[model samples]
Structure formats: C-alpha cells, structure tokens
Target: MSFIPVNEPLLNGNEKKYLAECIDTGWISSEGPFIQRFEKEFAESVGRKYAIAVSNGTAALDAAVEALGLAPGDEVILPTFTIISCISQIVRAGLVPVLVDSDPVTWNMDVTQVEAKISPRTKAIMAVHIYGLPIDMAPLLDIARRYGLKVIEDAAEMHGQTYHGRPCGSFGDISIFSFYPNKHITTGEGGMIVTNDDHLASECRSLRNLCFQPHKRFVHERLGWNLRMTNLQAALGVAQLERLPEFVQRKRQMGALYQSGLAGVSGLQLPLASTSYAENIYWVFGVILDASVPFDAEEAMRRLGKMGIGTRPFFWSMHEQPVFQKMGLFCGERHPVSENMSRRGFYVPSGLGLTQEQQETVIDAVRTIMDS
Candidate 1:
C-alpha cells in the first residue's frame, strides 16, 4: 500500500477560483479586497464584532497579548498540554506563564486547578481548546470573570465547535483562530484575532501592521512586529469560510467512522466522542496508549511509520520543557497527566481531506501496530 500521511488538507471549494481572481486583479498584497472580506465574514461567523488577520497563529497570539495591554511580569495562566505558541507569546511579552495540567478524559486544561494557580500578579487566563474539543469554557469563563482576569481563547483547532450552545470563540476577551492547512479552513498560513472590544480590535489591527501610527506616516511609539496576512491568504480563507459548515459535517462523519471501526481495540485509549456540553469535532483522531502498553508514543509512531502510516505525538508538557526548565520555570513541578499524555499519546491520520478508504487503511494499520 502507498504511504498514508497524517494530514491531507482539503481545498476542493473555490480556492482555485479565488486565487485566480487575486492573480488576474494584481491585488495580491495585504491591501486587497479579500483581506477585509475574510476578516469581516469570519468575525461574523464567530460572533465577534471585529477580526484582525495576521500572518500565522503565533503572530495572532503575539498580537492578542500586546493588544490586551498586559504589562511585563504579569502572570498568564495557561494549560501545559497546549502547543508552545500558547506560552511562548506570554513569555516573549515578559509575562509569567503559570501551568495547569490536563483533564485526563478530555485532555484539556483542568479548569479546577486554574483558580489555585492565580496570584496577585495574574492578569489573564489563556483557555486553549485542544484538538477537537472546546475546553470546559463555562467554568473557565466564570473563573476569569470572578477574578477580573482577561481570557485569551486559543480556538485554533476549533472552527465550528460550541460549548453549551455558545460559540467557542465568543467566550474570550480576545479569541484567535489559525488557518493552517490542517485546520477546517486553510489560508495556507494565516490567523485572526477576534473580539468585541473596539479598543482591543484597534490595538490588534495596529499590532499586526507594525504599530504604525494613524496620524504619523513614518514614526513608531511602541514596538510591534509586522505580522500582516496577505490578500492571497485571505482569498483562500474567504473560499474556505464559505464551506466551513460542510467541512465540519464531514469531520464528524469521519470521526464516527473511526470510532466505529476501532471500537474495542485493546491497549488504545480513544478521544472522548462528546462531553455534556460539546461533541468533539475530531480535528485529529488521537489515540493514547494504555499505561499497560509496553511502548511510548514515539515507539508507536515509529511502528506506524514502518507500516506506511503517519502519526504525530501529543504535545510535551510545557512545565517539563527543557527551554522553560532552563529558565527556572515549572521547576520541581510534576503534572502527571500532562507528562503521561506526552509519552503515551499520538494522533492517527485525520484530516479534512481524508477519504473513507484512507481512513480504513489507517484503522487497519493502527490495529496491526497496536495488536502486535
């Protein structure tokens, strides 16, 4: 059999058509029409009043952090189980990043632990929706409200997901989405920061455009990086946004097929299909080795690779990261669930472009590898 990669992006909508339009019009820069259209439409879709497009998800984070006006040495509590982008911006902004472990079942940050981590220096809570599931946002939001802390929601993996009938992106003071190929909607490499706050939205717009002064043409007051998204990327984003509904439906169907196919498979722990508030969108169909399994995620991925299958390991706990450890962060800290997940978890081939046949091949290969 041919090699089955982990994530094959789907771009069968108006992507080519839009790209052609961009090419023919010679409007390929950040000033193109699609930029504002994508931003406006995306903001409306997510129930946000404004959206500022940026170069990538990390840039979106960087912009969100600065726009919120978090001062240096302020603390931001975030999950240790999330991508480095979540904490990296916090650290880069000279803010303290406090760690919390993952909920073993949902693999999201343990909302209960968040309050305990809060200190007088804590200024915000960064709630990251992991994989396909929105974090337990209601409680997290409540925690933020009670503490008067801002919430920077990382909805990168959740495009159309909801929590208790509320949209995922709408919960935070500022929410971010990524348009990487693997996401439900792809802009090749782009991201957006959305919020209802007018001042914050203005701040983010300025931040992504190098903090250019509105009145002065060539002057800088405070520092900001150029992380502007191009018209070409926005053109792709506009097309993908049009098909988000159908794409989400397809993702659910694929997740159902995988769950049904792999049910009762021994020594593998599947992602929870749903919580009381939200059904997983299955951004990626992840599996965790039962502690009883003899090998770790690396070994499992190695075996899958040999079987012509592709897999990706789960995020290593930020608390235990070498970079953070060297900085004397999370020192002597032990988050058992996050550490165990990093070792035992890996996601199989789950992408918006996945086909039934390819999914079946992945399933069979997973069984072959795990049953061995």
Candidate 2:
C-alpha cells in the first residue's frame, strides 16, 4: 500500500550507543578515538594491516590513484561497466583509462580482456567488483604481477564477501571500500583504503588529510585534497562493522527468497546465484529484462513504480558517456555486454531493511508486470 524504497539502512545495532558517546565526549572530528578503532578493527576484519578512512568512496579512489606514485600519462585498465567513480581519479590524474568489457553471465569485468589492454605505459589495474559478484581476481592478480602493475581493488559492494576463502578487499596492492548506506556496512557517508603495504597505507593517510605530516603542520610537500572522514561517521562505522556478518546473512536470505519467488517469471535475467569460488552476496537483487521484451528498463521501472516499488537502473558504461565522448575517450570502442546491461538492467528493493512481506509484494509486482 505504501512506497517501498530501493534501499533503507538497518541500523538497529550499536549505532545509537556510539553516537551518544560521540555527542557526550565532543570527539566529533577526524581525530577522535572511534576513527582509530574503526580503522583498526576494519583493517583487521579484512585481513589487511592498515586502513585509511576518507569522506566517501570517490575520495578513496582519488587516494588510491595518487598513492600509487604513477606518472602522468601512465595507463590504468578498468571495467567500462562499473560506476564512474572507478574511472574518475584515473582520468583526473592524467592517466589513460583503458576500457574493458563485462562478462555476459556474471556482469563483472571480463578478466580475459585485461591482458590485451595492457600497454607499455600500463601502471595499474582497477578491479571493481560489480553488483553482488566479485571480479575473478586470480587471472588479474597474475597479470598485474607479470607486468608489475599495481592492483587497485574496489570492493565497495562487497563487505563480508570472500573470493576462494580469501577476503575481497585483501587482494589488491591497495583496496578500497565504501560505507554508503546501501553498502553492506554504513558510515552514513564514508570510505576506506586498505592495504598490507605500510608505506602505501601511510601515503593514503597523508593524502586523505590534506597531505599533512606529523613533523610539519600547515606545510605541504605535495598537493592533497581535504577528504577526511568525520569521527561521527566512523563511530557509526564501528557499530555497523560489528554486525556485518548478520547483515550479510540477511541480504543473502532476501535474495534467495526473490530467486525462488521469481523463478517462474519469463523474459527476465536474474543475477547469477553463485560461482565455483564464491556465492552471490545479492547486493541489490538486480534484474535485466530480456531484449525480446517490448520495452526497456525505463518502461519496466515505470511499471514497477506504479505498483509502489522503487527501483534503480544499472550503471551507464563509461565508453558511452557524453562527458568522456566529448573528451575523445573510448572512441570507436564497443563493449557489447556492458552496453546491453545498461539499457535493460535494473535492481529492486533488496536492502537489509526489506522485510519478507515487502519482498513478496515486490516479487508479485514484478511477475505481474512481466506476464502482462
């Protein structure tokens, strides 16, 4: 009867208790106790030695790109199917972003194309895990090793998810995670760069805080942006991080229910349930309408909206973006899989806040629209 949003955060954990402490103690800036605790515990959770918290996921990308110490005009290869944040800092650093396609089934970057994209100037690989599924890391990591390219893993959609018994964020030379509300964990609005390399971690810490140094304050050896994460955000993150396993379990349950309920629906492409190495975390219960259907995702979303269901469209491929096109990027390049996904794919309400009753309503609504 009422509108069900595409996402709503579940914060019935220690979020309130931590926030109260922040308010009572005046430890509200970037240098508070919760910031260190969140960073330390989160780094340990992901099996990394250090974590640097920042303002948002985009900032994490900026720091990851800058910390690599790659020269201008060096190339970074990444999926065209991922969020624009994946390519933003790469382009800003004057690094050429070599585009790659997505796999038809998994909707993740086709790791096969990565090697072909490598050039003499290739300096890094930005592997962004898509939706609820991870990009296959074995081949990519090997390629990076052989070419001596740094790996920047964007594990923004994956929190407790793993790849072949190892954590998603632990694979990269430097990896990043987002703490947006829709993510597996929420810091209201925050991001973190995690890594085993002590020097890289320290570089990220300085980059995040306007390149500030302990020995010298208000003096800069290099230019860095002010992308510091607030203590209030980290306070929420510390509480949210504690409940990640429970949250992950609930998300999977929600997805399983959708899969079973929507099994009979035709002309719809559901996310892959699992791969040999990892089970799908079902980040947002994404679905793509078959091209044979009379309409596209825009029409399907409109139909769902009328039935009180909120939905989100898949990412628009970087190659097709007007901004990039105007700048003469990805000229004459075609990644067919990502292009098709952009037109037909969209996600439903599969947040942790989604209940069985709400899910059932959504499932029935989708089936009804597709059948007619």
Worst 10 residues of 1 by lDDT: 209-218
lDDT of 2 by residue, 252-337 (tens): 99989999999968899999999988899998899988878999999999999999999999999999999999999989999999
lDDT of 1 by residue, 146-265 (tens): 989999999999998999878788989999999888899889899999999999998998888878897994799888889999999999999999998898899999999999999999
Using Cα atoms with residue i matched to residue i, what is each candidate's TM-score against the true structure?
0.99, 0.99
Backbone clashes under 3 angstroms, per model: 0, 0
- Give the alpha-carbon lDDT of every model: 0.91, 0.93
Top lDDT hit: 2
Error of 2 at 7 (Å): 0.3
Q: What's every prediction's RMSD, in angstroms?
A: 0.8, 0.8
